[model samples]
Target: MNFPDLQTERLILNQLNEQDTSALFAIFSDKKVIQYYDIDAYQTESQAQQLIEFFNKRYLENLGIRWAIRLKENGQLIGTCGFNSLNEKMKHAGIGYELAANQWGYGYASEAISKIIELAFSSVSPFCELYRIQGDTMIGNEASEAVLKKLGFKEEGVRRSSGFWKGEFHDLKCFGLIKPEFKAL
Candidate 1:
């Protein structure tokens, strides 16, 4: 399916156009933001250029989808959020989001993810199996964990040494919401 322009009550979830690359870089550039990410440079304009190229490639490939989050009243780029990982065999995708540190404590993350849950589990036909939504949070990211919980994702398990960040091992919290369980939300 083509990338979509999804809307939530307070945000317009539009596909990342040219104007969003720098804002994307801005979020990644913050060390505080990048600290929990699996692979992030925080930011460098050069890396932003590379990221823009990468997003274009993946979007064309239908392997990923991304949206630039903007306030409905103004189009300022607050952050980019969307699917970043996929597994065809598993018939599931990992949903992710990153926001400017300054934008925290608002309902944006939860609001954005609510739409993703619906999209993931939307079956095209009676014969189509549903897509499951999964997320992994580095064990220390309490804020992320809270967001996932508020969004109705279940804590499936914890992988000991689940992820390696900055060459050091850290447990990663695994989360998921299957199609059957989502409607209850």
Candidate 2:
């Protein structure tokens, strides 16, 4: 079955394609945007092109879903969202995304993530008994922390020096939004 394109008040979430490379590069080349991200900023247009192809292959394998975050008003790609780390663990499938720095506070991330969370637990598969959305965010990313909280994630704790980035070990906030606790979100 095909997943219908998802729309929020100001954004659309859909799969990525070659046509989006330019726009992907536009946001990904900004070093600060990926500062807390695991993937590095694209060094050139070709890197972005390669990333677009990689995204396509992942979908072809049914191994993951990556949706381009587009501005509904202009149909422009501002970011990407969806699940990563799908496996038997059930603990790893998660909602992950990044947006153009300019679009940071407009509710786009939460809107798109909320949809993915709904789909993951309902339309995707084996939703019954699934209890939570486990997530991790770098210690200082207040923006991401806030979004997760808005989505009803509770911070259980933090892992000290769990990630090495920018030449230093960083703490990562651990969070979870379980099914029973998610009703109000």
Candidate 3:
């Protein structure tokens, strides 16, 4: 299947390719960007390359989709946002995203994520089967939590010690939005 490219007023969400390796590395390598991210900050370009490949592989396998968020004006890759896990039969998916530290507070994450939520819940989109989209933020990541809340995801509860990374288990704030709850902006 062809990768679906999505667009917003200020951004473009498209496939990650080898040409994006350096930019991807730049985003993932920043300590600030990955502080709440599942993985550690990237130490090499190869890690970024591998992540790009993993994203493509997920798309091909129909497990999920991740888009490189690019600015429309200068075509700079600023971040990524999409379903990290998709379950068609179960009609649910888990969404994930991150941005370059310099790009924070610009509402780019919200803009890109809004588009993804629209497509995921749209009857005509490839991800139409998805009835629910969930986002989990590490407990202290207020920025991410705010983004999710602004998009209509209600806080389900805290998942205590549910996530393990950075050498210890961490609490995750669970948020979820079902089709009925999403009001497109």
Candidate 4:
């Protein structure tokens, strides 16, 4: 299947290719950007390339999809957002995203995410059957939490020691947006 490309008023959500390696690395390599992320800050361009390959592999296998978030005006890749895990039979998916630290506070994350949510809940989307989309944020990641809340995800409480990364387990705040809730937005 063709990779789906989505758009918002000021951003474009499209496939991540080799050409995006540098930009992708730049985002993931920033310590501030990955402070709340599960993975450590990328130290090499190969790490970023591997991530791109992993995302594409997930899409090819129908397990998930991640879009490169780019600026419409300059086509500069700023970050990525998409379902981290997708189970069509269960009608549920887990979402993930990250943005360049410099790009924070501009509502780009929210705008890009809103578009993804719309498609996930739309009848014409490949993800149309998805009934639930969830996100998990490390404790203290207020910025991410606010974005999720702004997009209509309800706080579903914290999962103690539910995530293990960066050499230790960390608590994760769960947020969920069901199709009904999304449609109501």
- Could you say which candidate leads in lDDT? 4
Report the error of model 2 at residue 59, Å: 2.9
- Predictions ranked by lDDT, top down? 4, 3, 2, 1
> What digit string (tens of lDDT, one per residue) describes model 1 on residues 14-117?
76766666787887888877778877664467677677678657767767666778888787778777677666677777778888889899988889888766
Pairs with backbone N, CA or C atoms under 3 Å apart (clashes), candidate 4: none
Q: After superposition, how far is residue 105 of candidate 3 from its true place, in Å?
A: 0.6
lDDT of 2: 0.78
Model 3 per-residue lDDT tens digits across residues 76-103: 9999999999998889999999999999
Q: Cα miss at 67, model 1 (Å)?
A: 1.4
Clashes of each: 3, 0, 0, 0
Which stretches of model 4 miss by more than 4 angstroms?
A: none
Task: List RMSD in Å for every model shown.
Answer: 2.5, 2.5, 1.1, 0.9
Cα TM-score of candidate 3: 0.97
Across 106-168, the per-residue lDDT of candidate 2 in tens digits comes to: 888999888777766663443223456777899888899999998898999999999886678
- Cα-based TM-score, every candidate: 0.89, 0.87, 0.97, 0.98
User: Between prediction 1 and prediction 2, which has the larger TM-score?
Assistant: 1
When summed lDDT is taken over every stretch of 10 residues in candidate 4, the lowest stretch is 120-129
